[model samples]
Target: AQRVTQPEKLLSVFKGAPVELKCNYSYSGSPELFWYVQYSRQRLQLLLRHISRESIKGFTADLNKGETSFHLKKPFAQEEDSAMYYCALSASSGSARQLTFGSGTQLTVLP
Candidate 1:
């Protein structure tokens, strides 16, 4: 079974501090990994992907294939960056499956 586990349900802290949103996954095949973020009431946006090795919204995610994890990290979080983050993966197919989202970690950035 493919599963994504985000241990933290909520993370609250002040602005301009480092933040790490942990994520671990289990899958038999090589699946595509991604970090999805939802701010306020907006749609979920892709933060980063394992294949891309890119950072978005001041965040970066590293895929540790051996560890079966893709943890999201940010050197310094901003007030505007406060949002719900989810770790997701999809197995591509003739008809690609929907991105499975984790429970979500509510990241709150104080003023």
Candidate 2:
């Protein structure tokens, strides 16, 4: 079974402060990891993918295969960055692709 874990349910940070959201996963085989974010009233959108090796909105996440972790980080936090973040894992289940998501982490950026 594949599982995604986000240890924190809520994280508060001041504007311009650095922020990191923790995430871990458990899967037998190689897994595809992704970070998804949902703004106040917007639809959920892809933040970053481990395979992409790119950064978006100053946020970056590296997949640590040995540690089975994919923690999201941002050097500087912005109030606009506040949102509901989710860690997800995609793996093959039989003949179909299965995605397992963490409970979610609500980030609040205070000015």
Candidate 3:
């Protein structure tokens, strides 16, 4: 079974400070890591994916296979960046892909 863990349930950082959301996963085969964010009243949306290797909204996450971790980082956190972030893992399951999500970390950017 694949599992995702976000060590911190709540994380806070001051505006313009660096922030990182820790994410760890356990899977047998090759897996894809993703970051999903949900604003106060908005639906959950994809923030970034390991496969993309791109930064979105000043956030970036690198998949570390050696450590089985994919931590989201941002150099300067903005107030608007405050949201609930979830780490997700995707792997092939039979004929389709299965997505497993973490409990999620709520990030609060203090003014």
Candidate 4:
């Protein structure tokens, strides 16, 4: 079974401070990891992925196979960046592929 873990359930930082949300995974095969964010009263949206090698909303994450981690980082967090973030793992079971989400981490940017 593939699993994703987010150590921090709640994180708080100043508006201009750096923010990081830790994510780690355990899987037997190559896994695709993604960061999903949901703002207050908003639906969850895809933030970034390891395969894309792209950054979104000033947030970026790198997949480290050696450590089995994909941590999301933002140099300067903004008030708008405050949201609930979830680390998800994509795994394949025969012909069906599914996404397993972590418990989630709520990030609050203090003004």
Q: On residues 1-111, what C-alpha lDDT tens digit does candidate 1 reach at each position?
A: 788999999998788889999999888888789898899989988788888788777789888989989989988879998899999988763346887778899999988
- Taking the candidates one at a time, how many backbone clashes does each contain? 0, 0, 0, 0
Report the alpha-carbon TM-score of model 2 versus the true structure: 0.94
Regions of candidate 2 where Cα sits further than 4 Å from its true position: 93-96
**Candidate lDDT (C-alpha), each:** 0.87, 0.94, 0.95, 0.94
Candidate 4 local distance difference test against the native:
0.94
Error of 4 at 35 (Å): 0.3
Indicate which candidate wins on lDDT: 3
Each candidate structure's TM-score, on Cα atoms with residue i matched to residue i, is 0.91, 0.94, 0.95, 0.95
Writing each residue's lDDT as its tens digit, candidate 2 over 22-56 gives 99999999888989999999999989888888999
Instruction: Find the 10 residues in a row with the least total lDDT in model 1.
Output: 91-100
Candidate that beats the other on TM-score, 1 or 2, i.e. the better one = 2
In the predicted model 2, the residue pairs found to clash are: none
Residues 1-111, candidate 4: write the lDDT tens digits.
999999999999999999999999999998889999999999999999888889898999999999999999999999999899999999853344679999999999999
Per-residue lDDT of 1-111 in model 3, one digit per residue for the tens?
A: 999999999999999999999999999998988899999999999999988899999999999999999999999999999999999999863334768999999999999
Model 2's number of clashes is 0
